[model samples]
Target: MKKGLFIFCFTMFIAFASKAQDNTSLPAKYQEKMTSIFNKIPEVTSSAATSLIDFAKSMLGKPYVYASSNPDRGFDCSGFVSYVFSNFGFKVPRSSREFAGAGTPVKLADAKVGDVLIFTGTNPRVRKIGHVGIIYSIENGEIKFIHSTSGKAHGVTVTEFNDYYKSRFMKAVSIVE
Candidate 1:
């Protein structure tokens, strides 16, 4: 009967709609930002946090270059973030200057370990957004971050968020979940 045929078509339509939902893929950035998308560690269980650290630790001791961001090889300030985020399926900005404006701004008091620290007062001004790092710790009023320095003391290193860093700091951004 016509009525029976209508019911069958309606049911098919509903099934197809649900199926479409399952086929949607998240943006590379959001995918990495999701808390369950990659390998995890105790320091970070969420995908964003884990991805950020993995990106940093993966380059331990790698020499800092002008614009490199490859762990198997070398990395620069922005190259470091771009490489790691892209490695895990996130679309990070290509340059440090562009990267400075990619995340939600947060206050120093409220910044979490996974937050991004932007610095622009060191050498090259924020003509773009220069110098970025991942927050490693925020304990007892002190903040620590990991980044590649290219001054007298260069290379990827971890340092505290003190007057030295504060003076050159651009702003803090929350680019991860």
Candidate 2:
């Protein structure tokens, strides 16, 4: 009886070890199985370009909070961008001004989705990147963007760069992947 118990325990231990090893050094057959499970999201937009849109869509209807960083708690303008991109593995700067430095500066005509839009409209006295938003789409010569606003309509909302946005438009930068 003692001999049988010893063998049983040893076999169990070996099986456990093999399973652990297989996790790291996965067998080719098991890897094929994993591919089916892994949702390989296709790149609708170029790298880093659509990360914001994907993150924002997932966060639709989240409330906006001042200086809050988490999606559950909602986010501020800068926090919203920071949380969204960072969640998708992109290293985004925390504040709006810092994030403005992350990408290449794109002209208004050259602006594309996933580009960071900076504005000085938030504070007139300041001629720097005061507010931030992510470009989502452009249609019929109209540009739409997603950003967290304060007080009214607080949360991530898609606003257009029509006359209203152009009035407050500062500049745009591209976060090249």
Candidate 3:
């Protein structure tokens, strides 16, 4: 069991390191810090959540297409979340706004992998659900999410829940218990 745990932790570290390298938006120092924190996370015991996150990661680099859910054609923010949950046999809201009332609400601090995170539109002043993503991981009290974004990256990517997102963050909901 000890060996297995070590291997898992090591593999996770390598994976995070590679992802951090790919993400150029964050400064070198921030990437290194995030990778270090990822290494210290306890082994995730939920197979279902792991599977969902893995699947979501597989879509990284896919383009962000507005009002579309097809992987081949790409997906918008809500479309990406909808497609991921639907692929896992979960009935989820198709639109971002619809997700406001879907699933059981989970506090931001207590959110886990596979939970859907809703956020307001680009203009946070609107105060309405217009974007969504899946919690990719939570380590050292920091949350990273996977979503199809039209921002700088312009594709499916994992993003840290930083100040920009915090201002737009509406709530998080658990789809897989």
The lDDT of model 3 is 0.90
Q: State each candidate's clash count.
A: 5, 0, 0
Q: What is residue 3's positional error in candidate 1, in angstroms?
A: 39
Each prediction's TM-score versus the true structure = 0.66, 0.68, 0.75
Assess the local accuracy of residue 35 in candidate 3 as a C-alpha lDDT between 0 and 100. Answer: 62
Model 3, residue 30: distance off in Å is 40
Say which prediction, candidate 1 or candidate 2, comes out ahead on lDDT.
Answer: 2
**Which residues of candidate 2, in runs, are more than 4 Å off?**
1-48, 123-126
Off by over 4 Å in 1: 1-47, 121-128
Error of 2 at 89 (Å): 1.6
* Cα lDDT of model 1 by residue, 38-142, tens digit: 223234346577667766776766778887776756678778767766776776787766766687889877788777787874754333356888787677888
Displacement of the residue 97 alpha carbon in candidate 3, Å:
0.4
Candidate 3 or 1, higher lDDT: 3
The predictions' CA RMSDs to the true structure, in order, are: 12.6, 11.8, 11.4
Error of 2 at 72 (Å): 1.0
Q: lDDT score, residue 67, model 1?
A: 72
lDDT tens readout by residue for model 3, 24-108: 5878778777766655554444878999999999999999999999999999998999999999899998899999999999998
Q: Write the per-residue lDDT of candidate 2 for residues 1-177, one digit (tens) a residue.
A: 999999899788657644654353678778756554333323422756665587677876789888887888988888998887777777878888786578788898988888888876455465766778888898777888888887367788888876656756777887655
